[model samples]
Each structure stands twice: as structure tokens, then as C-alpha cells.
Target: MNSANLNIRTDKDVKEQAEQIFAELGLNMTIAINLFLRTAIRKRGIPFDLLLDAPNETTIAAMEEGKRLLNDPAAPKFSDMEDLKAALDS
Candidate 1:
């Protein structure tokens, strides 16, 4: 396959940081970029699947609070949609 050179300008600090990391793994910037581009082309998108981790502390705390409210034994239970709507409308 014929390959052409690609040049791009990026943030110096970010590039330096990435360079350091890749260097540690024995990859230079050019090789890393070529590998990434090849992978993306082969996959027809970004090479890796992205997985979202659970949200940060505030979000987790709010979710826990919601769970506690939903599971509270003393909390009034809604028997049906009408009851739930009535509870919400009050």
C-alpha cells in the first residue's frame, strides 16, 4: 500500500506527555500515529471500544440516596400508576 506523510499541529504539553509515555513503551510519535491510523482504517472507526466508568463521587452519592428512598420500608408504596401520579402531583 502507498503511504503519504501526515503532519499535524497539537498542544506541546499534551504531545510531550504522550511522547514520554510512548517512548517508555518503545514507540515513537510517528509509529504511534501510523499504528493508530491503520487500526482506525481497518476497524472503520476508532480502534478501541470505549467503556464509561461509574460517575464521580457526587453522582454516586445522589444515586445511593435515590436507592435508599426507593427501598425505604417506612416510605409510602404506590399500588398503581394512578397512586404514583397522585403522589407526584401532591
Candidate 2:
């Protein structure tokens, strides 16, 4: 079978980190890349979910509220489950 050389450019740190992971998994970079290419070809796209791992607007607002509560001295602090239940029931 005839093969062609593929040249890919990436950040040095990223390449080093990936190389370390692949090595730990008992695969060299070439084998790992070929496996990815084969899987992509079989699936007609990337074989994994690629997503931006950022919080949504609602989640961001909730996190900000949590931080505000954490910093506020007057925020209610429940010492036990009963206290929490009482606070909730009131």
C-alpha cells in the first residue's frame, strides 16, 4: 500500500503533552494519529463530542449569586439539617 506523508503544525507544549499521554497509553504519536484518522473516516466526522466547556448565562448568574452569598456576612448559615428545614419552612 502506498502512503503519503502528512505534516501537522501544533503548539510545542500541546504536542509534548499529547505525546506523554499517548506514550502512557502505549501508543506512539503516529499510531495515535492514524487511529484517529481511521475512526474519523469510519464515522464521517470526529469520533467524539467537541464542546466549549463554558457555563451558560443562567449558570454564570447562579455562580455569581453563590459567590455573592459566600462573601456576604448577613447570609443565613444553617448549622444543621433541622435548622435548614426550619428556614425553608418559614
Candidate 3:
């Protein structure tokens, strides 16, 4: 694959932090960046989610409720894929 130069300017503190992380992962900054670019090209999305944090309490509660409902023994069961598909079509 062809490649070109990508120049970015970051604060020294940020660069130092990134270098430490890359070192821990056994990769230099260049390799890490190349992997990121390759993955972004392949997936057409950012290499990582980059979320600041997980869902907050309200969102977590709603997700847990949904999971409970799905796994409840008393929940109705569809016979097969076709039945589920039919239900969706209806």
C-alpha cells in the first residue's frame, strides 16, 4: 500500500503520555498510528470507540432492565427463526 507523510503537532505532555502507552503495548508511536489508520480505512470508523466513559446510572439501569426482560423464564418464546421473521414482517 502507498503512504504519505502525516504531520501533527501535539503538546509535549500529550506526546509523552502517548509514548508511554505505546511502549506498554510494545509498539512505537509510528506503528500504533499506522495500525490506527489501516483499521480506520478497513472499518470506515475510528480505530477505537473513544468514549469518555461508560453509560451513566440511568442508561445502565435501562439496559439492565432490558436484559432482565429478555432473559426472564416467563418471557414468551418463538418457535424458530421463521416464526421470529414472520412476527417482524407482521
Best by TM-score: 2
Query: Each prediction's Cα lDDT score?
Result: 0.93, 0.97, 0.91
Candidate 3: where is the Cα deviation over 4 Å? 1-3, 50-55, 58-90
Which is the leading candidate under lDDT?
A: 2
Give the winner by TM-score: 1 or 3. Answer: 1
lDDT for 44 (candidate 3): 97
Residue range with the least summed lDDT across 10 consecutive positions in model 2: 70-79
- lDDT, candidate 3, 1-90, per-residue tens: 687889999999999999999999999989989998989999999877777877999999999988997899997568899998888899
Residues 19-86 of candidate 2: C-alpha lDDT, one tens digit per residue: 99999999999999999999999999999999989999999999999999889999988789999899
**In model 3, which range of ten residues has the least summed lDDT?**
45-54
lDDT of 1 by residue, 1-90 (tens): 787888899999999999999999999999999999989999999999888886999999999988998899987887899998988999
Q: After superposing candidate 1, which stretches have Cα over 4 Å from the reference?
A: 50-58, 61-90
Off by over 4 Å in 2: 54-90
By lDDT: ranked, best first = 2, 1, 3
| Model 2: lDDT of residue 63 | 100
